[model samples]
Target: MTIVETTSEVEAVVRDTLAVHQSFFLATSGSAGPWVNGAYFAETGLFTLSLVLEQRGRSLAAIRDNPVVSVIISTGSPTEPFLQAQATARIVEDAEADEVRRVLLAKVPQVEPFLGTPVAAVELRVLSWRATDIPNGWLPGRDLYDTSIPVAREHRG
Candidate 1:
């Protein structure tokens, strides 16, 4: 059976995974084969994403070779590290780039500085997701799916 999750199920997992981590490994390919780069990603919405690019060399090169990409953002909790949420990447075109930027900048700081560089803006349309056990198998896909992510109480910022 093809287990494509419902939009809510997908959104729940994406939101939870996004909240747990600030960055993800973006995988891409070139004439060599495959490559992965890391960056802090902003989940603007269900079908939108934007990540900080310190430099766009490798990533932009890969995108130029091929537009397909995959991003894996995992909860690094040693207790359960394999429970990762993934997003399929689609390089956003110039026309829609500003819209995605606006959504991401709302939650992120110092975005304008990064835009000064020749950076890349990637859009991710979440296809499927699987959340791990949460103190009784009540992962986000279960009845406890909650999208509310309040600012972390211990956030020093």
Candidate 2:
């Protein structure tokens, strides 16, 4: 296993993980209670993913009430590395659906057949992430990235 040190390396690991994984488990909670479901995703940007969700699905309803969510992307192999992320989600605007649709199909062509169905494009903005591989082990704080933190503090001398 390659040593995953440094923020850039961690980011690369995340991008690589997202690129190879076609689906992830999304967990959400709202009035309907907690719900976890498999969702096909496409990385639309740095720390961002897009999905086409059924309009009336419980997942969508939960997301509508509570945008906060968590996702796990993994093959469930102990030796293989996997990432877990906390993200905020939102339903894409109608004007943006076409672009999201194009991007989604580019990465997940299998979704093409469902594009015409009654579904809405959802975007997930990942807040933080951590990668864990039982074989490689974790470096605690070094292995986690949180976007909410300021990269650098302004120095007033």
Candidate 3:
């Protein structure tokens, strides 16, 4: 296996991981202490992940106290590696809520009934990410939006 070392390579890995997975683990902390929960999520571009969370849930309460979070997107197979990300989360409101709902429902339609009542939209702005396993070794976490490294592009003749 070739080592993934470039920014584009990292982006490709992240994009591919998100494409195949619908749910991820969210870790948060608050006055009540730390908590981790699984949540269905949808991605917008490469750095933003969205979810509809129950307003009264522990995860939401943690977010209310501390917006920082860590997320894990896994293939669920014991042998496969997982993607880990650190993010800043916030509640989505007004027009943005509608868009969040649309994106989420497109990925997980069963969540429709939970839209407004006790559930609300939250967006996680990714700060950095790393993969559990890469070709050479574990890939170290890097800026979520880093575009400094050059990526090889294919040119069609």
TM-score of 1: 0.63
Alpha carbon lDDT at 89, candidate 2: 93
- Models 1 onward score TM values of 0.63, 0.85, 0.81
Q: Which digits, one per residue and each the tens of the lDDT, describe model 3 over residues 106-131?
A: 98887777775788789998765675
1-157 in candidate 2: lDDT tens per residue?
3544466777777878888988999999999999998988888876788998889999999999999999999998757778887788989877787777888899888988888899899999876777775665554422444445443112111
Ranking by TM-score: 2, 3, 1
Clashing pairs in 3: none
Q: Which residue pairs in candidate 1 have backbone atoms (N, alpha carbon, C) closer than 3 angstroms, thus clashing?
A: none
Residue ranges of candidate 1 with Cα displaced over 4 Å? 1-13, 52-56, 80-88, 134-157
- Whole-model lDDT per candidate: 0.57, 0.80, 0.78
RMSD of each: 10.1, 4.6, 6.7
